[model samples]
Target: MMLIKRIAVALALWFTAGMTPLKAETTLLFNVFVPRSNNFHEVTAQWAEEVKAATNGEVTIQFTAGNMAPPPEQLEAVKSGVFDIAFIANIFLKNKAPLLQATMLPWLVDKSENASIALWRVYKKHIEPKAPFPDAHLLTLFHWEGGQLASITDTKINDIKELKSRKMWALPGPPADLLKTLGMSPVATPAVQVGEMVSRKIVSGYMGIAPEIARDFKAGPYTKTITWFPRSVTSTSFSVFMNQEKWNTLSDKNKEAIMSVSGEHFAAMAGAASNKEMQAALDEMKKNGVEIVPANPDFYKKMQAAAQPQFDAMRKEGERLGVNVDAMLEDFIKESESIK
Candidate 1:
């Protein structure tokens, strides 16, 4: 009788276990290429929290603490499943994502928010159909605020003629190209090294950087004046994406939840955060006695003219890709202006 009782109890326990449902949980590995204190990284952490909330804890993101790969290798890292998600600078993928260069063109959009939103809308309408980066799932696109020219020398840039023969550090691509075309000796420099380059007097000034960059990179002390353009000279573009296989593993419900906090929403959030930082940085730079000089009308016009060849080149490339580059540009500008 005792043996029968023991068997009955075992059967009951087994039945109870079988009736209970198993919990499903997923954690995605996120590769952070930027510094932990950077605005972009902070915003991304918030985005991860939103995703978790939206999924009711079914999905979560785990940051890798530091970069898992080089900046240019991030896309491939995600595609190969080394990381489930990564932040990729579009400039590095110029050969594969040429159309993305539109966001980096001279005198385009002024605010980061507007530029990001416009890029997403235009990309969906025009560039998406081209099947760029078919190996990964793009979550959203974003760009930094327009960059201004900063000079360390006493002679501020009041006219385009003043820029002639002056060695200036610029971010590679359109910014450097435009500076070179305008008769300035352009040296390609990374943001982190700008302060060192300046202190060493390697260059007279630097272009294609925002005020926040100057503040964070410790370039303010060496920077005497900033030549502000109504529409910034150029900006850098970035894309947040996930591995195709990992994205496919997500249930439809979870996928929807994740996307709810992505796309244009993510873009706007990132831009607004950066804008706030930019304002604070500007205030700090002013306290340090860095003068903000407005660009002369003739100088601005000259810059626009020098950028014409860049636009033309983009159009030619668009023709090869069967995309109407003009339409995309018009839509991007219109969408950007329409936003507040």
Candidate 2:
């Protein structure tokens, strides 16, 4: 009996000694509802892999799509550390951080890699440190090129005159403002519902980035004409935000590894994805008998002139908030031009 007891005691001690406690390494979770097939998802996955490799397993990340929570709640969730990290839409959280919307103003920058980089740089320098994002870390920001106007109606909208009195789709907020300026009534419809609405004739037309129309939604069947008006550029600015406490717990080396893969590097990937998607969408539209008509230069100039008042109103609001809106715009233009 004594011999058996001794053996049992020895084995238990040995087992305990050999067992190692699970080390608490940092892990980030991203809410990626957009299809994994999309370019953003691909690049984000690459970024995660790079971080894991760089940390040598010291840090890990997990990405989940389709509303880990609702999309609108993501901003406050990140601030409260509901997830270790979040990929948020800049405009969706504009109520929480209106200053960020300055860059999102329609037609602010030209559609080139330089434009994106410049805008992000300005945000990092002047915008991130503001009160709104104080609870989280700001990572990358980028924009999509302005998408063309697409219509399902028998009458094509080849000119501003044709667009007048057209029931056009608007993605809420500033988009409505843009439609109003164009003398069109805002059709308050989400992108997901676009197919049903168009097919039912609830709306005559809508505008969106080409890639979205081509790859994900198959917009060719619904829309018959693609008016090549480089309407308001609507880029969804994404941020790789970290929960404040979790971020503070990370070692400096790990933080630097994550940040290095962020900002302009991610912006570049985003821009490339957007460019490719746009081309693909255009091709799809053409196959569907969608006549592509470039907007007249005179018309474009006139629209810009009208939209200028809205821009001025925004700038004035920024000034009231003590932000240098004019300087930011000037800096953005300068940086965009400089990007080759």
lDDT of 2 by residue, 1-340 (tens): 9999999999999999999977658778876656666677887788788788878778988877455666666757877766666677676766667776776666665563565687678786666554346457777777765555677877777666767757777565565677787667767666666676677778788764443543355456877776665544454555556777778888998888877777788777777677677677667667767788776787667656756766888777777666778887788778877877
lDDT of 1 by residue, 1-340 (tens): 9999999999999999889675599999999888777888889889999999999999999999678899999999998888899988888988888999876899987888888988888999999997465579999998887789988999997677778757788877888899777766687878888888888998988888899887788788898999999988888888999999999999999999998999999988887887888888899899989999999989899888999989999998899888999999999999999998
TM-score of each: 0.94, 0.84
lDDT against the true structure, per candidate, is 0.88, 0.69
Top candidate on TM-score is 1
Identify the runs in model 1 with alpha carbons over 4 angstroms from their true place: 1-20
Candidate 2 regions exceeding 4 Å error are 1-24, 109-113, 129-134, 208-211, 230-233
Q: What are the RMSD figures for all models against the true structure?
A: 1.9, 3.7
Measured with C-alpha atoms, the lDDT of residue 35 in candidate 1 is: 77
Clashing pairs in 1: none
TM-score, candidate 1, is: 0.94
Colliding pairs, model 2: none
